[model samples]
Target: MLNEHAKLLALFKQTGEIIGRKKLQKMVYIAKKMNLPFNEKYQLHMFGPYSEELSLRVEEVCQLQFVSEVKEKKGGYQQYRYELSEKGEDFLSMMSFHFPDATGMLEDMNHKSSKFLELVSTVLYFEELPKKEVAEKVFKLKAKQNYSEADLDEAYAYINRLHQVAPKKGAYS
Candidate 1:
């Protein structure tokens, strides 16, 4: 089985671009919420669900030359983007043999916008919200997404199922 670091490299490989750190974090968090076998533990943070372990793994991958980090000034603020290095691609290729489903999962997630991931992840983080209240809270938190009640309902149904099946403790740690 691929370890969490290897799984992250596979995600970078699947994305095939320099993904923003926040996007990466949210993607992993969503994957975990979806019961995709990621082992990271997440808690609500300023930007929504955040994981220190994921951040540490990113740094580790950078140090290992499996991934490269680039800093860019976007909207006059510095942001980091991560991409798979040649070594990382090679590692991902090897890992694919052991975990074929990972590519498909990453591909599905890569198609979602960061904002959408954030919306779903935030809702999942607060799964206890009453069914009727979910849309209100989600709209308040992510008004820019323009999500409808129907959207929140669908997401809630899906995430709720995954949350029920997902391991209670860290799966990867």
Candidate 2:
């Protein structure tokens, strides 16, 4: 079982993935997908181990420059919402950090520069081709060799990992 702090961090990480959306219910749903237990209605003022602590953490995030807050009331319940600010979005964009296997892809590309460049050209031709397509093309190329599926997986994984860190290109802007 995971601790609440870990769960909260997971929630923050998941929430960060959902850019431009400001609905607690949606955030809760995303949290659920991430296997985090989240209460639907949150009371920020009340101090307690669960809801209150969560509220404080949320509030602290909102107090930061990169976060924005919105409030909504429905059926006797108050909901506070948070989204990334432009500055936050810009900060996220400035970060070109890659996920776990990104380095491996860099090395592979370095070793097979022509092949990788060809695949990259294919990727660019589609003009908004999904990461899946890029992975597939690369996989087809790798099939001629004895490479593991790890490279293709890494490509998609890196895309998703980037998504987790920030919004897609032009989404936050």
Output the number of the lDDT-best candidate: 1
State in Å the error of residue 64, model 1: 1.3
Judging by TM-score against the true structure, name the best candidate.
1
The per-model lDDT (C-alpha) reads 0.73, 0.40
Q: TM-score each candidate.
A: 0.73, 0.29
**Across residues 50-147, which tens digit of lDDT does each residue of candidate 1 receive?**
99988998899999889989888989788887888999878777774433245555566566667667777888777787766766777777676688
After superposing candidate 1 on the true structure, give the runs of residues whose Cα lies further than 4 Å from its correct spot.
92-97, 102-105, 139-173
TM-score of 2: 0.29
Q: Write the per-residue lDDT of candidate 2 for residues 9-89, one digit (tens) a residue.
A: 334333443222223323332233222344434321211112344556555556655567766785697655455566555
Q: What is the C-alpha RMSD of each candidate to the true structure, in Å?
A: 4.5, 17.8
Clashes per prediction? 1, 0
Q: Candidate 2 local accuracy as lDDT? A: 0.40
Clashing residue pairs, candidate 2?
A: none
Displacement of residue 53 (Cα, Å) in model 2 is: 6.7
Q: Candidate 1: lDDT over CA atoms? A: 0.73
